[model samples]
Target: MQAVILAAGKCTRFWPLNEKHKSLFRIMGRPLISFCLENLKRAGLKEVIIVQGKKRDIENELKKEKISGLKIRYVIQEKPLGTGHALKTAYSYLKEKILVLNGDDYYGAQEFKKVLSFFPSILVKEEKDPTSFGVIVPQKNYVKEIAEKSKKPPSNLVNAGCYFIPKSILKEKIKKSSRREYEITDYLRKLAKKEKLAFFKAKEWSPLSYCWNLFDIKEILIKSLKREIKGIVESNCQIKGRVFVEQGTIIKSSSHIEGPVYIGKNCQIGPNCCIKPGSVIGDNCRVGQAVEIKNTILGANNKVSHLSYLGDSIVEEGANLGAGTIIANLRFDKEKIKTVVNGKIVETKRKKFGSVFGKGVQTGINVSIMPGVLIGREAVIGPHTLVKENIKEGTAFYSHFAGFKKEKKRI
Candidate 1:
């Protein structure tokens, strides 16, 4: 049996962070697709088919990794259609039995095993908000009916985008959806009427559909990491709990770490720095003196040097945070932080959500950013500025907010 990984997504939501496909987005020093493939590897399946678009960014990485003799194949989806159309593109490479999965999602081994246990089943899980997803109607462990967004769903069980299907599905006629795209759920719903579609309820599913999903995914990845200190720990350093310090990483004097935290290869963590739990600092990064990083995901080569506090944030690759910079994770009201995505207020559903800085972003000294803000790629944030809104990609901002005693223009 083989697997079909759907990766050809025309992504726009993961802005600044993704100039390319979302599958190529790095998480914990690995691309998002890497985790999915790793889960497939853990599930004991070797042969694979990946459907991607023009760039083939994922293909390049997979080839470079050379995943230990893993037989891999790729198909280009010229048109940016829905999942149903993507699966159709892999018709030439389909096997007698295949597991169809989303490429950007990171599912655990236990759930994949459950889906594989049933050859003709669809993996599903109970979601809190089923209206936004394809809801499943189960009857005696088999899928009775599948509905996409009803006023009232039959059940809370939603599609986790993992399916066990025959190769003959490629021959089925799929009609275009109302949105002018072909959806796999519609095809599966129709398929359920004529054939057997078993259902397996999964216990864990971590989807990377939005930016906020990274926080939970990062925490899950960090927690499962084993403790290994491959780097140098200087004197007067306090290491509590399990921490994975990769090779060439050096923790200087007077730094304290509370783990399940990870420091990637060649990282330079400094003196008087406090790295709290659930933090993952990537390769060649620098965390300088008097800095505190709490549960933040600092990408490779980022520099947060001196007197900075990063809490529950995501700083992409090659970012530079100047001294005395602070990213506030909590709102004054303490309510769930909401970010405006494409002029729509999308709730992050996080009470302690910090800002997301894209690749190569630079900040001047003493910059302060509000919660749920997004700074674009290669953007420049000037000194003593207060960021209250999103910054566009490749833009430079130098605005500051200060209340004047009288009616006057503020910085």
Candidate 2:
């Protein structure tokens, strides 16, 4: 069997990080889509057709991996349409029964095995809020109807977006929904009445529609990473638990590193630093003395050669952190961290979460940022700056405490 991975839609919700394709985002030094592809290869689905849009980042990434046993192809979605249109973009390539999966979601191996067991199956998961997913109304071992984000869903079982459908399903004429786009589930809904649509329950599902969810995804991927140490661990360093240090990475003496952490290749860690659990530092990252990095994901080539405290944050590629930089990761009343999304307050539901910095962002000394703040790509934060809100892309923020008046030198 083959799989058609959907990588088209514009991930606008995943801002800052959205500058790049979400599937291209790295977790534990690997792309998100690579995880899904690995499981598919193991499940005996060797051929894959990826439906993508605009950018060729996903296609470019696959070329570098050169993953064996997985034959890959790409089809352009051209315009931003619905999932149905995205699938249709690769209609010419669907010669056999295929498995369709969302490229951005992390569907583990267990879920893939279940989907392959049933023919014409749609994998569903039990969700707390079914508003985001297409709720499946089940009848015995098959689906009766699928309500796409209805006001009140029939059941809590929602569509996991992985489908196993025969080629005949593609023959159904695509109809546009109220949103003015074709929906794949609408076609599946039509088939449900005439035929019994097989169903499979997914054990794990992760929706990466929000940028804050990066922390949770990072934590999940890190727990499964094998503990390997190829870097230089100087004497007197307390390295506890499962830690993977890539080649050329150095853990300077006297640093305390708690486990389930990954230090990427050529990373320069400190002589006096505390790398807390769930911290993933990418390649060529430089961390100086007395820096404390807790539960965070630092992208490739980030520099923190300064006294700083980064807790529960996601820093994008090439970010430069200055001395005395502090990221506040909690609210005063201990409530959930809520951020401003399109001028509206959106609760993150995370007890401890920090700011998200985009690529090439730089900060001066003594910069303090509040929780849930998102700094966009190529942005700059000046010295003694206090950030309490989100900053857009290419913005430069500076602090001015005193008025510039050459009045008497105050001598």
Candidate 3:
């Protein structure tokens, strides 16, 4: 069976990190979609169609990767309609049975193979809070109904966005839901009523619905990595656990690294620094002296200056953190950190989520960013500034006279 991956969403909820498609977000020096494509290839699927946004960014990014023997065709979804509309845009290309998946989610090859074993099947996972997703009601081996984001969900088995369905379902016209957007679950609900829509429970599912979800994905990816070192580890440096250091990277003397950590190519780790576990440092990054990086994803070409502490954060490409900068990842009361997403205050359910730095972001010396703050792309934070809220794109934020006077200038 052929596969269709839905990647056309605007991802407004993933702001500050949504400069590109969510699938293009990298883990372990490769885009997340590349991993999904590789998994699909391993599942013995040769033909794949990707439904991407009008910008064609996902296609452009995926073209750089060499997933041999997988023939990928890109279909454009010009509008910001829901999943049903996105899938409908690729309907003309559907032939025979189709395996559908969400581009932003991580699924294993075994899960794909399991779903493909049954005809007209929907992959479901038992979730604690089913209200956030489309919960599936099962009748024997088939799906009875699908409730989309219902306050009173019938069951905890939620739709995992992987479906093995016949092409005849694509021919049926789908109506817009109450949200005024076409939903794929509506088609599933109709199918459950008329026919036996088979259901398969997935072994694992990692959906990147929010920015902090990256942490969970990172942890999952890092666990599968084996220890390999091609870089220079100087004497007096202490390395422990499963650490993968790429070529041309140097771990200087007096530095300590505890892994489940990945250091990419050409990175210069400090002579005196601490890299704690669950940290992935990308290529061409500079983690200088007296810096302590813990459980953070440092993108390529980033510079973490001396005396800085970045913990539980995601610093995107080309960001430079000035000296003595500290990112606070926890609150005084230790409650779950709440972040503003699309003007709504949403709890992160994580007590230690640091700020998210967008691409090319620059911070001055002694900058202090609070927990869960999102600094937009190319934004500048002046020295001695304490950032507590979200900063918009291209903004220049500064404070004077011990932060008594605050200013925001759009760059």
| TM-score of candidate 3 to 2 decimals | 0.96
TM-score of 1: 0.95
Can you write out model 2's per-residue Cα lDDT over 1-411, one digit (the tens) per residue? 789999998898788888878888876677888988998988888899999887878998878875788889988998877998898889887976889998888888778889888777889989887876678888998999988787688999988899888767878886788888888897788778778799888876677878887776676677687888999989899998999999999999899999999999999999899999999998889998989999999999999856899999999888999998999999999988988766777778898989999899999999999999989999999999999999999999998798776677766
Better model by TM-score: candidate 1 vs candidate 2: 2
* Cα distance off (Å), candidate 3, residue 29: 0.9
Off by over 4 Å in 1: 400-411
Residue pairs clashing, model 2: none
Candidate 2 has its poorest 10 consecutive residues by lDDT at: 214-223
For 1-411, candidate 1 gives per-residue lDDT tens digits of 698999898777777577778777776677777777777888888888999988888788777764763588999999998889999888877877889998877788778899898768898888887876778888888899888777688899988899888877667787888888999887777678878899888776877777778876777777678888999999999999889999999999999999989899999999989999989888999999999999888999999969999999998899999999999999888999999877788888789999999899999999999999998899999999999999999899997567776866776
Q: What's the CA error at residue 158 for candidate 3, in Å?
A: 1.3
TM-score of each: 0.95, 0.95, 0.96
lDDT of 3 by residue, 160-255 (tens): 999988777766778788888998887777777777889889876788898889998898789788889899999899999999999999999999
- After superposition of all CA atoms, the RMSD between model 2 and the true structure is 1.9
Q: Give the range of the ten consecutive residues with the poorest summed lDDT in model 1.
A: 61-70
How high is the lDDT of residue 110 in model 2? Answer: 79
* Clashes found in each candidate (C-alpha, N, C closer than 3 A): 0, 0, 0
Show the colliding residue pairs in model 3: none
lDDT for each candidate structure = 0.86, 0.87, 0.90
